[model samples]
Target chain A: MDGNGVSGAARHAAFAPLDDGGRAEVVARRLSEAIALGLLGDGEQLPSEAELAAQLNVATVTLREALSALRSDGLVQTRRGRGGGSFARSPADASLERLRRTLRELTVHELREIGDQHRAIAGTAALLAAERAASEDLRTLDTLVDQLAGAGEPGDRRRADGRFHIELAAAGQSSRLTRQEIALQAEIGELLWMPSGEAVPHPDAVAEHREILAAVRLGDGQRARVATERHIGRGIDQLIDFHLRLARA
Target chain B: MVSDVRAEEMSAAAREVGTALDEVFAWLAELAGRFAAMHASSVAEQNQLRAADLSQLRASIFPRLTGNPRLLAGTGVIVADDVLADQPHWLEWWQHAQGGTELEFLEVDHDPASVGFYDYESAAWFVVPRDTGDRVVVGPYVDYSGTDEYMLTLAHPVSHDARFLGVAAADIRADAFEALLLRAIGAVGQPAVLANEAGRVIASNTPSKIAGSLVHEAEFAGSPVRVVLNQDAEVRDCAGLPWRIAALRG
Candidate 1:
């Protein structure tokens, strides 16, 4: 929950000025990414348009345009008159039919490739994080792992899972790596970890995260890399099973 | 004292916009996941499937989804296949309309071997994701195929196992996006401009600073809202890509 340090690292790499044209799109895109990453909570009230525009160094007109785009996309809703400001809407669930369609598209091979890339980035990040992480960073990672373990819903668990990896990346102190981790999560994190019929068994994942954390705390890079890679490898297997079932269905 | 009040209002607007964007991306990610999933299945099931098969899948899947209603021109999907020749997917939604809506969904294909002018693979939307294997939102460029209008494409890569399938994407007309910008600024009560990362103005209340013009940094100095710009700028990242929102008062 206290992710100020991690979020700052993420924002450092995530936000950059637009060169020309598409200002609104850029504004809209950034906010959307933040929302997807769970950096912004559902139904969170936003700052005043004037204040936000100035903060972003964009024209108020441009900020508003971006907001309007979001509104059209059903991401934000506006109320009129007093207390009439835009608020974030909870994300819509992808229809089951759509999920089926999506499942049909993904293959076991691709899942493994995604898992492989995840292992490289996450393994390296964990190894580096172990070497560089402060006690505070370790504490945050522990808390996130705990959060994931306790999360009752798939969505909460998924977000916590994502934040744990991102925080690990931040601990490594590489904006590039942190950004890469964030992008990978944004791209395939949810789908790869999505829970089918019952909740995804979290005990193993929680234990794996703890093992990586323990190694990082002990400053054992080799142990951290091995643990992180194994953790991801296990996830990849679970996802493959999920996809296989979908294909067979 | 007046500047303080103005600053507060500007801050509130920025927060609102930020929150709104969060919602948009959340929705998009879900759609991308579904598309990627479906595309993956298609690739896995039929590795040797023709371009026509992909086209048929696109035609069936894209038209059914209820895209943004504010879209001036309707939305559709595109699948660029290197192996298959340029076989375009005609927009069935646009064709069967009752009213004389001045809209046309032209069929454009990206054929690597084509001698003609257009190359879809070269487009940023297609190339970026293909190279990175990440979802991409590209545009505000002239879409030669459908309506010859500036458009935004929300595209994701489709891969089966390790084999890359094709790009699954949706196009939203740029004018629709511009309209949204125009309305947002009109309500904010300030002379403002939205510029891309390259400093080209995308939208502006200042009529002189039209779209496509380089946004001079000095432009923020003379406006009533300049005090707002004096404060630290807020940076919003879009679609997990490098694109961002740097709002400046002018």
Candidate 2:
């Protein structure tokens, strides 16, 4: 599965190496993001080392180093013997204590800064997606939105939610923007939509996704941008509230 | 209600698995302590331990300890070392185990080349106790390197005086656990699952709902023990791990 959850075409484009020295780090980051987004499921067997290294376009040694780094991070496992190969380990739940610690470590200003960057990137992607998205792209976006709406678990919903945004970026027909969206989602995606004591209900986010999709489908660039901004803004507000609550507790 | 009976059966089955796991953990803790002592003495004596020491350890230990015949699929230990530069000894064990009985002991090198260009330090069984300083239960994951069967790992940290040695570990085949679970709750007519903290089903009575699929706790709201739930699922702690017994009633 290679754990990225995207179709083969999109994955190829997104993972194409941009530079050399940091290739393994980039590959590792991309895979880690995919794993965190639940695109790569727990216990899923990864592709063979040669195949995966070829897919990521790196030397076998580089891929090995990246895999080593991932192992240290507890995101992957290697077993030996007949059928033994590397497998994805289930990520540890972002413990409330860890969440609280993260919040304590960040100031409100920094959170707002991250939110602002997210809004700019997401807003721009939505605007472009509305302008350039084809009928098929729109259909894909709709399907992802539907998946989000029907998703019952927080983890499933979160992954679908992340995919919807990345798909929107892809619909914009900009591989660069899609890559940026992937990186952005990797950074704040899990924390922004982290499960809490029913603080930020998923239905509201799913409803916002529908609005964004509807505008994008109609090629309403302005409306798409507005919808995207509002959705991201609401998420930012909820995260701030969560941060404050955790800090106080 | 029939749901009550089903819940009881499910709990009983979960408890059985939990008890088996508890015994496994106790054995691991004792083994880990012995290894820790040996490792400390080796370090003190400046002994240039060869790969043979590890092979001897595995031979002495894995062949001697017998686990629950029905519940356990295999038992083995992995020590953290750089003894094998190019090929992992665990892969050798896996090859040997494949030729022998259904269950076999296995080990892996932390080095990537020996482990199919993969590293073991990233695994939960190795990382959790190293990070949390506690014994940990990991998986219902496919042991692609061992039996290629879905298995759960019980691991304890082998450390001495704050110096971490390696992990002492064992593998429990999921099919065995699933068989036991199905025997307990298969006739209940409701989907029952035992899932880890991540909501991945470890064992389930529903054929379609196989192990490793993500299941939410909300799916089990109708479960009798609802409020004591951890995360999103109705759960009762098993073996001090985050594993839980959850059921979805029709």
Candidate 3:
């Protein structure tokens, strides 16, 4: 991918140099996101401390502090001796309780802000896709919607939903949009589909995907954008509602 | 008559690229040959090669193969499903995890039921060579499933005693590979686009034909300035690779 393209651009942003203050926490947060998102696969060896520090543009001491914190959190484990390095340790399931706690920590304003960013990216992707998408791209979108419809578990639903958005962005033929979509999906996709007291409204989600797909197939850019925004808008509302309900509990 | 000369030049340039890519495949074939030999010898000794043995083999060759870090992000061997005694599916792959100095084993879920499962068997890179018994270049597209990088996967089938065993594969970063392609196409000094069989542009000297954009053959059907090279010719070195160079008469 071209460096100016979205995927490359996103990668550049993902590993870009950071500022000094609270550096350890920032590094820890970013690495946490990458692991949870499978950007760093389970049991994958992390770069050496010095190499990682160089890549993240932080001091070796700060990188060590972040790695230690992740180790204590059970997200990373270090082996002693040769072939010994910090490895990502993703559990079989992303803990629902942990997700709930993270959600509870976020303010309504923060949730809304993230939603706005998603809408911007997804909406534009839909609009472009209506004009640019080929038959094969539409077929992929159709399959993802069906996958969402048939998904019986929260994990399956999350996977289907996240892939739909990413595929939609790819259909837009903007690697940049695809990369941003992946980042946003990694950040909030799991949360939106979190299996709580009430299961995520998959039938509604499937219907929304259908609407967006229809608009794209018909080359209705305006309708596609509107449907996409509505879909994301509803998800944001549901997340906010989930946060508030957890607060009450 | 002038168009004939341009067509000849375009074909020559395409062949040059074909030769370079074939050399990469030849290198992978050598690796595959080693893997096949190891598998065969282990079988002859009545002891199947274990995952550890494969991993050790990969680790041994990884450093030497990665001397040109810009051309390849990683390389490894993936055996046929259920071929390994230790696991149903196995990939003994290692990569420079971040284009950095450190090499690490690639971690992927092989479970069919898991959401994160990497179904390499279904992937073109594995399937094409495995079935055809030939080398193949699979992409200049995003690898969302594995490395999450846009890369070209070059692979060759490994076989022993007429039985297919696996594929020796390498991932080439798209940017670096594209630069190589552009250099080849640029040497022809013509406005040209190199596309895969799907008509997806791999690289183009002309801005109108951007990389990753699909080309409609009909759009240039009647244009006298357009010369679709490789329409009927299969460059010998790239016999199994389906790519073409479409050059415009500039």
Candidate 4:
């Protein structure tokens, strides 16, 4: 309403100033970009409603509604007053179902890329986890492995197995590495969670976790690395197989 | 880190954080409104403190001592609950003092359990000569004598060209301050308090019926802050810590 518009911090950092595409579009674009670029950073705060509303030339109600969508998507978190602001987190939507939904949206090529990237990173992690995983951390992995091996239900086994690998990632003993492994694990689990896409992960995902732990426990870094890679590679092969079948059909 | 999956994962994290911050903002605004109401009420009380001249108030309303010039030397006439509890006969003295010209004022000094009253004459009718020997009776009808022991004092020093003259002080009792704080805490009650300059319990509306130990002090996570700084009464974020509502002691 005032001179071409107010290009405040929220405008430049958060909203679209020139196009004046209205508030929702501006906020959506900003939020999407912020997520994509990791600009918000995990645990960093987003601007306040009044700040966003003023920048977008929108009302407080509009800003709040936009935030609600982000909340539903598991992208942002809201707290009440004084220092109320949104926080950013990597893979904030860590739920098994969300991982499935996100993986379902991926192309076969993207799945291959994800698999390759994870193999490279996790190969390094398995090597480190063997050398670096503390006694307590290793015990946590061993206990979960025992649970994974002993679990009754298919769903329970799958969850425990996932937890065992997650423990392995934590055992790697670096926050950055652990965080990255967690994302990769989410990707791997998602590829399997959507049963229609990948059939390989469904067959022996539980057993694969055991092999990796067994190798790591014996202080055999090389075997641990290979077993971890083999398990993940098997999941990738299934995803590729399904993709090919889909094309043929 | 700059990869596609990394990008997508980071995006979700940002969104989660953003949502939580919004909720916190809503909570802070409500607190500001409550302090504003307290500010208005305190301001009105302070004006009454300003109406009377320094000398007149010193002799009549200042916390005087009982007897013996070697001591405070004046049977303290304040709103002490001990004395007000047995009024009517005692208050009948006011109804009949100096052919009956009781200066009007709030009953806090008179009654800790009472709300407030406007007794201007009760204050004006009782001024003694100052060191200057000036006896022109001035008028500050409000009294901050004995109300609830817990009190909020906002002291604005009456100044002269950047010089200190006297002070304009507003005293809100613990009960009145509690009403203001309750409005701020709202339905989802967060423990809240208004501490005085000395960190003494000025007020609290918390529902925890402190059966024994809670006699006067408020319950807090740590020792209360007692320092007075020059700042506006406002709600502020404590860096992901507690959302604090700090009202300046004025």
> For this target, which candidate reaches the highest TM-score against the unseen true structure?
3
Tens digit of lDDT per residue, candidate 2, span B161-233? 8866667776676667667666655654577777776566767788756665556667874652211212232
Predicted complex 4: DockQ: 0.00
Better of 1 and 2 by DockQ: 2
Lowest lDDT 10-mer window, candidate 3 chain B? B221-230
The superposed Cα distance between candidate 2 and the true structure at residue B66, in angstroms, equals 6.3
Ranking by lDDT: 3, 2, 1, 4
The model with the greater lDDT, 3 or 4, is 3
lDDT, candidate 3, A18-85, per-residue tens: 66564897788667655543345567777788888888899899989998988987888999998898
Candidate 1 runs further than 4 Å off: A1-249, B1-31, B42-69, B72-77, B80-105, B109-117, B160-162, B221-250
Which 10 successive residues of model 2 chain B have the least lDDT summed?
A: B226-235
Query: How far in Å is the alpha carbon of B247 misplaced in model 3?
Result: 3.1
Q: What would the per-residue lDDT of candidate 3 be over residues B1-250, giving only the tens digit for each residue? A: 7567766667766777666565666667678878988988888998987787786576445764568677788888988976778887888887886746888889989888986788988787888877777667776656777776777788878888878788888888877777877876775565777776666667778887777666666644223222222333332232234677777533
Task: Give interface RMSD (Å), model 3.
Answer: 2.8
How well does candidate 2 score on lDDT at residue A145? 87
Q: Scored by CA lDDT, what does every candidate get?
A: 0.57, 0.64, 0.74, 0.43
> Candidate 1 — what's its lDDT?
0.57
Model 4 CA deviation exceeding 4 Å by range: A1-105, A152-155, A194-198, A201-203, B1-250
Docking class of 2: incorrect
lDDT of 2 at A74: 83
Candidate 2 global lDDT: 0.64
